[model samples]
Target: MSQRQRYAIIGTGALGGLYGAMLARGGHEVHFLLRSDFDHVTKHGLKIESHLGDFELSSVNTHATVDSMPACDVTIVALKTTQNRLLEELLTSPTRDGGVVLVLQNGLDVEADSAAVVGADRVLGGTCFLCTNKVGPGHIRHIDYGRIVFGNYSGALSPAAVRIAEEMVTAGIDANATDDLLLTRWRKLMWNIPFNGLSVALDATTKQLVDDPHAVALIEKIIQEVHGAAAASGIEIPETMIDKTIDSTRTMIPYDSSMRIDYLNRRPMEIEAIFGNPLRAAKKVGAEMPRVEMLYQQLKFIEAMRCDTC
Candidate 1:
């Protein structure tokens, strides 16, 4: 077996916990830098109920702060963009020279922020196509689909990206590496723009949106706008991805989007990253995304209300 790389999970939410646990299970030295659930995770360790399988780590390295953790070969930043203000402090501590920072985040231009702290050469963008949630402290429920498509922010796959992809594949994650990170980011935005937006704006789950014909049509319209936006920005998303995304969602387990979950939990939503940033990027290139713009406005209002009350 190839040597396992030491990994640090910067956020122990769904993305961090699931992937970090899999890495630990694959025999990698994994350290989880936790926060609110630090005591629980420290005592009971990590627990995951995944479609792939159920697993438990009775004893794993857990730390409350980055300063308490050892430097690692790869650090996965899975924090929601809402908490990104903390990145300037949290990103630099747990990585070593020549180590890579893998950003498993949502929305556009996320890696650049990480790159600002870590050199651009040491950063990789990982787009996760999965339905998993942290149901409780130290516990995550993986609903379905766990494929992670990796791309380099520098426009070409680097050795670090390849090594991380190989490690993920060994850990049982459906992983792939792509050369065009911008194209890959646009591809992810194609799905994220409509579903995450409508799911929160309309107060519905993935199933509800797909089952209703009216909602389905709206989704298609939003997707068309996204395609135009991508093209306006010089990135081309295939026309067929719209149908494929809708069909895939139709078959997914009745799941609450991360945005919807945030809405229900009264936490701040990731409006800027998922919707606002994409909208600005589109408008800069002369693309008119009326549907997306409207959704963005609604979400902004909803985000304000959620924050005010919570």
Candidate 2:
């Protein structure tokens, strides 16, 4: 077992709640910065339903804001990228000097934005391959898979990244550490770009998307575009990865993507981080992705419509 470290979870959503609950159950000191569910979680604690098993923390260290939380050894920033503008205050407030800020959100180049607030040396990018969701307040349903890949954002082997991975592994998560941050981001985006965007655009599940012939063809085009973008950015993602992702999704439980779920619930989706940013990056490097560009424009329209109604 690894030594237990103090951990703080900002944005107690599906990702944050699941990982933080696992850590707290493993005997780590886990504090949660919650907004609406602070009272319910503080009273009823956190409940996790996983295929691995089910567990409930009768009580956890909970706070409504970062100011009320204590400095911790590592802070997991799991907030959706849509809420990233709030990260400066959330990260710098309760994170101690030299404390690790593990960014466990989705999208490309996300770590750089957070690293701007927390030092690059203190930021570690994390990619989660978990199928999980917050079924209700203080409750999470882990559908399947819970592996994490962490990378040093400072271009070196980060001691903080290694230690944080140890803690995650100790808590029964499949965790690994890497030295290449940009490559990690690009690789994760390979899966995120096609599945997430198409899921929203088509209003379909993973199985539904893969089951359609036209959808399958469109998915490949998006993957190839992402491959080109990654190569132009000086990161090479194998073309074989596209087939592997398709094969894996065929076996996955029919699931609505995060973007699709967000759109259904009328919450803001992560259009800019996942599509707009990557599209702009590819364009800057002279990579043309007409399909991806079309998807970006459509998402932008949906987002604008949502905001106008608000």
Report the number of the highest-lDDT candidate.
1
The collision pairs in model 1 are none
- Over the stretch 1-310, how does candidate 2's per-residue lDDT look in tens digits? 4457899999999899999999998889999999989999999999999988999998889999888899998989999999988998898877898788889988877887788998887888888988998998899999989888988777787777787888788898888998877777888888888999888777789899999999999998988888889999899878898888888999998788898888888788888888988988998999998888888888777766664322
lDDT of 1 by residue, 53-169 (tens): 999998989988888888899999999988887888998888888788999999998887899998888888888999999989999999899989987888578877888888889
Q: Which lDDT value does model 2 have at 279?
A: 88
State in Å the error of residue 205, model 2.
1.7
Question: TM-score: which candidate is best?
Answer: 1
Q: Model 1 — TM-score against the truth?
A: 0.97
Candidate 2 ranges with C-alpha deviation above 4 Å: 1-3, 307-310
* Residue 6 alpha-carbon offset, candidate 1, angstroms: 0.8
Candidate 2, residue 89: Cα displacement in angstroms equals: 1.6
Instruction: Name the regions of candidate 1 deviating beyond 4 angstroms.
Output: 308-310
